[model samples]
Target: MNGPDPSRPCLTPESPPHSRGRSCPPSDQLGNSSSSSATTPATDLDSAVQDNIFAQAPSETSSRPLPIPAANALRHLPSPPLAREACDGGARPSPQRNCCDGRPAACNHRAVSDVCASLPEKSFARHFLTSSGTFPSAAEILKKAAFFNSGNRPHDALLLCNAGLEVYAEDADLWNCKGVTLRALGRLQEALDCCREALRLDPGNTNALNNIGVALKERGELLQAVEHYRASLVANPHQPTCRTNLAVALTDLGTKLKQEKKLQAALVCYTEALTADPTYAPCYYNLGVIHAETDDPHTALQMYREATRLNPSYVEAYNNMGAVCKNLGKLEDAISFYEKALACNANYQMSLSNMAVALTDLGTQQKASEGAK
Candidate 1:
């Protein structure tokens, strides 16, 4: 009879319980040896298929992620995580390999610390190659590199990516991953080159397009950045993060237009930005500013309401709402809005000054009413 399939569980009744149902890779495929311990080196994956392809990539694990419809630039520069299940051909990552310690509240620092501390120098490339006589697959190397990226160890991540590229030169995801790690290290030109290479390999790669946008944005090429963001959206319309990035770019561009007194063009950009992501509160706030400038207080009030609805803690929106109300001769409403702004931020000088003026106006109006009565 033929021996058991290395890709399947042992059907023999005498197989040990621990070895049963494990779906271990062929000894030649993974390494020369198998260990019962869960603490195997990152390369010695028990089953490459066991990785959770749907798990969030390291870049998606920001402690303070941008709001769904972020109007400003990203809260933090994001690194694109590994490919999804569909993109990775269903290869999933182990939980530890995907976990990040970058966010203090989200990770077990000790586990990351142990992993980093125990890692042999050039572990994936040198040690594993020497011991197993085969390089780990691109997916495996990417997982370990992602783990290091999560721990804020970009140098290690870069090392892993470079090594993987030597063996899997045509892997687009590897190039994209390396690009993001290089971007993290502030190597913008090199990062852009890698992302461009990934784009060349996979023409419709949204991650490469998005990273290219990031690099351009960093270089202060807003218009070029906008083009890349638009290209990425065309490739994957469901990407909320990319949509937010687009909105941010548009908003920034609009501000520049407004400064140049191109009011109509600025308005068009703001409208388009809101169209891109209606939940972006700052865009609404910006719309309110434009309407207020154009002598449309009522419309401005509506826009301000939308802004406050999306972000209740938006002090600027509240303050501007107070200003709009005051201009409309609604002193009481203006004071209330000012008070809300102050509650959100007691040290906001604009609201403090506006609040005092509103209170003084209310007092003066009360005195005049008493005298008339």
Candidate 2:
């Protein structure tokens, strides 16, 4: 019998887009022998690669604007670049790219899934795929889904996450991502189901718990949302986002209680929220409203001023400040604040109405002074 012929893997012209800044050398080209002799430990090599990946990661604040009100505030806000690139179809690995020589078969699906499953839980790879040189694997799909979610393409993200779940149904992170996308799409019941499934798999999943809180909050289940937010905070106390969400839920509860003549209880809730996050602007604003409603204009003015100081572009705070000034008979100051509110958001109907009232009051005062003269 003739000896088996030597098999060689055919190299394809196309490869997956590079991840982060890592590039894979072409398989056909063997580099200089001297260059290949540098032996780095596997641990060091992995650390170096990760460091380079981190270096290539974009800064989050670089793309975020001041969140000003404008004709196209939402449109002008830069989408997360990582998320945008994931769904762009530019990062996909070529199907014909062989992983090993002499075997024409591409990388197995299980191998791809395993690589994704091994990623660090809180790493950027959990939400974004680096563009250096890594090929599209199952992890890349999950990252892409996350990118879609952050980029406000929740429907697309949901589809990609669902596809990933088909291959790795037991992935708690994937279920969490699916839940987030579902919630963003307003499919609250489905989102709840997905989040519950994620929590069932990983009882300590803070992300799932936080998302469940958001879904419940949106559904007007304020108490339930508060419970979930508290649970999430218990799991990860350092999550400021969850703290903020909890504060909002508490504020909502306080508002309802206040309307029901539970002023003391409402004050307690607002005080708790402020204790949780002293610098939270909305909490201060809500506190100011509570004080104003309870006939304490001085305290209300103090809270409104603090809110505006923390967030200068907070139009509602400016409007509230104007109301406090008007009550104090500081007509000129009230007008100034109302104008500032309108400057921040030209279409603010409340500011417009208040400005008209202030103008009328000023005119009446001027006319009365003229008659007395």
lDDT of 1 by residue, 1-373 (tens): 7763432211101111112212222211110001110112122223322221111111111111132110001121110111111111222122322112221112223333333334566664345434554446666666666555544466777777776666566666677778767766767799789888877866766767866776675565768977997897787786665666666556556655765779889788878877777776656666776677678879988987997797676666677778778767898998899889879879766667677777887898999999999
Please write out the lDDT profile of model 2 over residues 1-373, one tens digit for every residue: 7542222111101111111112112111100000000112112221211110000001111111112111000000010111111111111122321211322323346644555555555554443433444545444565566555544566666656665665556665567667766755757799789878867766776666766775665566778977987897787676654565566566556656765778899788878867765765655666776677667879978987887786676666677678677767788998999998889779766667677777888889899999999
For model 2, the superposed segments whose C-alpha errors exceed 4 Å read 1-141, 151-156, 366-373
- Per model, how many backbone clashes are there? 4, 12
Model 1: pairs clashing at backbone N, Cα or C within 3 Å: 51-92, 51-93, 52-92, 52-93
Model 1, stretches more than 4 Å misplaced?
1-134
> Evaluated with lDDT, which candidate comes out highest?
1
- By TM-score, the best candidate is 1
